[model samples]
Target: MDGTIAATSKTDARGKQKDKSPRLRKRSGFVFILPWFIGFLCFTAGPMLFSLVMSFMNWDYMQNMTFVGFANYVKAFTQDPFFFPSIRRTLHFTAFAVPIQVVLGILIANLFNKKLKGKKVFRALVYLPCVLSGAIYGLVWNNMLNTDFGVFNYFIQALGGEKVEWLADPKITIWALIMTAIWAAGMPMILFLGAMQNIPDHYYEAAEIDGAGGFRQFFSITLPMITPTILFVIILQLISSFTVMAQVLALTGGGPAKATYLYSLLVYENAFKYMKMGYASALSWIMFLIVMGITIVLFLSSRKWVYYEEKGGNI
Candidate 1:
């Protein structure tokens, strides 16, 4: 009976150990991610919350915070002169740039995927802009787009055309930025190449066996397979285009006029340059809502286009 009682106690201890093991694992995982969690809360979430609060207030860095209750937001929509133009310019850039980049990426990826000589070198050459310093690229392009003695205008002159004001004219400045963006379209192409490589060879083989030509195969098989990647690239480009400021700052500094003054640059100017923190916060929130809304629409519409193999091609 004493031996039996000792066995029962041992079994109970074993069961207790099993219970504590899961708790210990949970604690260990929390401890492992504690640094990231703390950093997120302190840096990302904390600042976002603070910014949200500040959006409703009238506080500069050196002043008392007075809660104005949507005054900043209302002012941004109704009174601010830059608000609509900035949004319109940013959206205009996005509308043009994203589609061009997407198509260019697809074409480059297709070219890179083909079994051609010196393909690796071509890939690296195309992707160089993506990895190279953006500031350097901006400086180089800034000079290249100069009205006189610039490579682009020199070529145009060689063709007996006029030297265009690529950067100076407000009418042409936005297009110049668009051209710069397209020049760096190689990253998305590389991404699409990755997506393209993942597509099963059997699909292509079957299409060929069915007498489908190159265009037919691409339209029916390749494109369908890469729709998910296309969606991802579009979303990424959308966000990037909307928040583009540093490159614009380096190149045009919002232009010969405010023609290239994007929405994000407007926010930065208000926050840091003009010291209108509250107003800037309102602009930031508006930009966030715009992006979030567009992203949501994309996602909701993605069910029709974004093919997920894991879902067995079902929405």
Candidate 2:
């Protein structure tokens, strides 16, 4: 009876140990991510909450705090003349730049995916621009796109075309910015390349066996498989384009008649330069809402097109 009791106690202890193992693993995982959670709460969440509250109050470093309700928001829309134009310009830049970046990224990625000579060198050249500082790139392009005596103009003159005022003319400045954006398409290209390489070789092999040509195989197999990556790249590029400021500030400084005045630059001017903190906060919240709305729409639409292998095709 003593031996049987000892054996029963050992069995219960073993079962308890087995139950605690999963709990231990979960606790360890949470512990590993605790720092990130704490940082997010302290830095990100804290600032966002503070900014939300400030948006409704007339806040300035030099002035007394006054609760203004939605007056700040109303002033942004009705009183500020630069507000709507900035939004339009930002949207225009996004519209042109994102599509071009997506296309160029896909093409460059496809090129890199091919088995060719000097492939590593080509890949490095393509990715090199992504590492360059945005401000530095803007400065370099600003000089390059100079109306007279710039390399671009020299080439145009050699070809008997007129010297184009790239950054100086309001009509052409936005396009110049868009061109600069296209040049920095390296990140999305690298992402696309990674996604393409992850696709199983067996799929392409099977397509070849089915007498599908290269173009047909790409359209039917490669594209469908890479739709998820495309969606991710689009959303990321969209957000970046909308929030673009450094390049615009460096190159055009909101430019030849505020033609290139992005929404971000406008917000910065109001907050720091103009000392209109409340208005800036309102603008920031508006931008937040716009970005969130677009992202939500993208996510909802992605369910129809974004393919996932685990979901048997799309989710």
Candidate 3:
């Protein structure tokens, strides 16, 4: 009778353990990934799949998708003269704007990270440009940069220089765009500030004790400590840079002889303005491939320069 009771108790215990295991594991997994899973399906995965399907069909929102196989893609390469030019313009913008932003953001972030008087107010001032609407920002800058009466040109003239049409001339127009885009570097600046603050002061103190000057300490200690943040910011900037359409739309509009017609603008024009949905999708897919390839290359090459504090927590 005692043996029977013991057997029964063991069986019940095993059953309870089995039930609890699945429940605990399931709840943990759900808790860990609910947000990401929802975001991926709703925002990332769904859009990607939908775009993929749209790329194969010539749809204009008025008619059914007419399957054209590879014609749209072929035309983008072979028939479109604007395609290469737009790509070149985009590359130019990315190359020029990204480094400038990164350097400026880092500098500003480091500055704000230090204990200074009214630092919060200064940081807020720096970040003000990020909250403004693109069109509004464009209009404001347009008025401020106007050749005949804009405030900037007026100041330049007052400082013994001629007024320059910032947006009309090709050479100056691209530079104007670069300047405007750099203003939005405030967010990255804030991000860098946070990363810098998170870094322990012990590293800098140790470097100083070892006879390191400010520049040396910055290069050796500060840079390596914040490399992960740099890598993350660069990746995000690369992806975002490819889609630099809003500023171009408001400021340049492909401008004096199609100099600043970025790929995104080109895609938008073809897709919506001209009803060339299939061709637009092809352009978008090409952009996707370029971005993906660059990202993969960066990931593979990150071992050379990306210094991580821990072994496996790469951003």
Candidate 4:
């Protein structure tokens, strides 16, 4: 009986030690993550907290900060007419750019997914615009769309039409910018292509066997299967479009009565050029809130559209 009790106690101790081993492993993992945690606190979290604090105060780099307590926000919403206009312009850009990119991405991805010779070269060529710098792309497009001595205008002239000041005319400038933005749809197209390739061949084969036509199969199977990736791309594009500064800066510089004055441009002008650091911080926080709110709304709405292969199985 004494020997059995001793063995049982030893087994219990061994079991406890096994449990303690995982705890030790967890502690070591945390130790390994400590540097990254510290860096995040110093770089990301610290700057974000500093910005929040600064936003509530009146501070220029040259002077001491004085707490004004939401006055900057009030001014942004009420007194600054530029703020609302910037928001409207940003939303307009996002609304146009996101859907256009997503639909075009899907179209291009579907086309590329087909078996063809020189497919690899075609893919690379299509993706080239995405790899090029945004500023360079904008400059190139701006030259192309120029009223005089431009290829587009030359074509228009050949077709018996007058030159259009694509960038200078507020009515038509947004369309010109949209054309520039669409060239970078190559990235999202690549993403959609990747998602498309991951889809099993069995689904298509099964659909074919069921006598489903090409369009029907695409609508019923291909689209639903790809919905999650599409949703992700749309959200990313929307966020990116909101902060699109480089293209507008290089191409139009918010041209023709500030029609293209994005919120980021306004923030840049305030913080750097005007030395309104507090006001800029306030603007940044408001923009952050707007993005977060939109993201939340998308997430909530995605339940109706986004598909998971594991759950309910359809879009």
**Tens-digit lDDT string for candidate 2 (1-315):** 456555545555675756655554554456556789999999999988988988999977698989999999999889889999999999999999999999899988888898889977888898898788889888898899999767889999999999999988999999899989998788889899999999899998998999999899878987888898998999999999989987888899998999999999999999999888887988999999999899899889988988877758453
1-315 per-residue lDDT for model 3 (tens digits):
456555544555686756555654444446546679989999999988888878878777678889888877888889999988888888888888888878888999888877799999999999999898877887788888887889999899889998898977877887888788899888788888888988898888888789999889778877788888887888888877889777677776778677677889899999889987777888899999999998899888888888876577844
TM-score of each: 0.92, 0.89, 0.86, 0.89
Off by over 4 Å in 2: 1-31, 311-315
Which model, 2 or 3, shows the larger lDDT? 2
lDDT by residue (29-130, candidate 4, tens digit) is 566567899999999999999999999999887899999999999999999989999898888788888888999999888888888778778788988988
Top candidate by TM-score = 1
Residue pairs with backbone overlap in model 1: none
Each prediction's whole-model lDDT (CA): 0.88, 0.87, 0.82, 0.86
- lDDT of model 3 at position 152: 90
| Clashes (candidate 1) | 0
TM-score of 3: 0.86
